[model samples]
Target: MKTKTALVTGASSGIGRDIAMILSKKGYRIIMVARRENRLLELAEKLPGESRIIAADLSRAEECFELYEKVRGEHIHVLINCAGFGILGEFEQIPLGKELEMLDVNIRAVHILTKLFLADFTAQDSGYILNVASTAGLMPGGPLMASYYASKAYVTNLTIAINQELHSAESRVYVGALCPGPVDTEFNDVANSDFAVSAMSSKKCASIAVRQMFRRKMLIVPGFSNQFFVFAARFLPRRAVIATAEKIQSMKREEQNS
Candidate 1:
């Protein structure tokens, strides 16, 4: 059997990094992508199998296109769109430029890469694409972190639609969305937010995500509580869901201010 290769974005830290490590241990060569070249180099050294590093800022459209070009021929058996960040603040209060950047990474990047690779994978009739979304996307809306939540919702819904398309076509190409809740990673630090609930370790989150990806799960919501939240949201009134998200995000803002 030919050795499989996986391309993982946002691999410098957090769930992306953990998934890379896990894939390496599973004997898949990982092509790590992130803006932090030094961090990628360090992770490459630790991997049990072969690895390559591509340092690119995924927020830029050209960079996202270029990234796909760089690795498409490598026969990547899996593509993990794990490169994304969120900001916590009132929708209007946050700088528009920053929100755009976040959307570029969280929405645009994921959209572009998924579109390009889905074509390739569908043509070959074999591959897996795991998009790292969030439980924030599952809810109706978020209050303080409105833009961030909306960005994730785009990812989640996009993945859902794509999965439906692939299934309708009876295609073997697998596409899934990993909608994990607050993970104990550098995410909160970078997003300038606080977790209202205890954060799960990145290792645990990655383990579940990768495992579910292999199992062909459409929506890989990690924790039981998170699964429940997503399910419960469907039955709750839209306004109530928004209000709950408001309380959670409001706590994050309060913590940041303190």
Candidate 2:
């Protein structure tokens, strides 16, 4: 039996960490990448199988390429781009510099890493790539989280389009976009999304994602309720959906303030 290798970004915590752990348990050697060196080192030590930690801030383009170079000789069977960040507030109120940083990490970095890995996977014509988008990608969110929604939308669409192209080329590569809603991770603390109540656990979410990846599913919206909501958002009028999101955000703010 051969040990396959999986590269999981943002693996220091939350969904990425869980994904790395689960992959390791399934007999895959894991390469955990994140900005938090201590957490990544701790996770690598605890994983069931062989693992390594690459502590690089993926927001930097050079670091993204550096990671690719770091594991050049290894055969990467899976590449999971779970590294991203979000900002919540009026677009104008958010600092332009902060918005650029969000785009750099969430959109640009994802694209860079995906492109780099896809070249290798395409050459072999067999591998899996998972891009973690959010259910917020399905529609426009309220003014508070506008840029974050747009970035996720880009991820969702890009993943689908790439999957189509791969199929057309008769490549065995599988590309999946994971669109989960309000997951119970450290993400809420960073995004300041107080509406995240009874959210799905990172462990549960990653388990489903891993299972679906091997099954070659193109898009995975984890929970049934979340899937239903995404479908509804797709069919609803844009204005109506935005208005509803505004109400939800307002209620969330009240909850946080109280």
Candidate 3:
């Protein structure tokens, strides 16, 4: 049996780390990428199969391309973009510079890596690309975390459109989005917006994402409750949906402050 290689961004922690571990257990050699070199090193050492660590901050566009150049020779069978963060506040109150930086890492980084790797994958006619968006992506709006929501929306819609293009071209390559809802990870710490409700475990989220990606699922949303909520939002009035989003995010803030 041949050992496949998977390149996972944001592999230092959370969904990315768990996915790397899962893929390694499946006998795939993992290429872990993140800004935290120490964490990546520790994770690589713990993987059951062979693994490598590349500590590149995807916020820098050059590094995104550099990562690809460094790994282009490797027969990468899977590419997972999970490097992202969110901030919770009214759109006007949030710092513009901070939101711009978030866009660099969240939207630009994913776009760059996905496009570059997708071309390579399509050329070879084999590869899986999974972009980790949030269930926030499916919603019409996010009052408190507007920028973050918009970033994820871009990821989700881009994945859908690209999947359509691949199908039209009759390509075997697969591209999908994993839009999990409220996964318990360092995201809350960074976003400063803890979930008002129970959060799903990151391990479970990663497991489901990997399984569905291989099954060629275009949009993988874990948990039935989350799936139902996303579906129900479509029929609700846009104004009502936006108001509900505000209530939910405000609850998270209230919980954090309490």
What's the true lDDT of residue 139 in model 3? 91
In the range 1-258, model 2's lDDT, one tens digit per residue, is 567899999998899999999999999999999899999989988998998888898878999899999997688999999998887777888899988888888888889988999999988888899999988777776657889888999999999999999999989999989988777788867876676346898999999999999999988999999888888988899899998777766666666667
Off by over 4 Å in 1: none
- Candidate 3 stretches greater than 4 Å from native: none
lDDT score, candidate 2: 0.87
**Residue 125 error for model 3, in Å?**
0.5
Per-residue error at 107 for model 1, in Å?
0.6
TM-score of each: 0.98, 0.96, 0.98
lDDT score of residue 241 within candidate 1: 89
| lDDT, candidate 1, 147-189, per-residue tens | 9899999999999999999999999999999999989999989
Query: Could you tell me which residue pairs clash in candidate 2?
Result: none
Question: What's the lDDT for all of these models?
Answer: 0.94, 0.87, 0.94
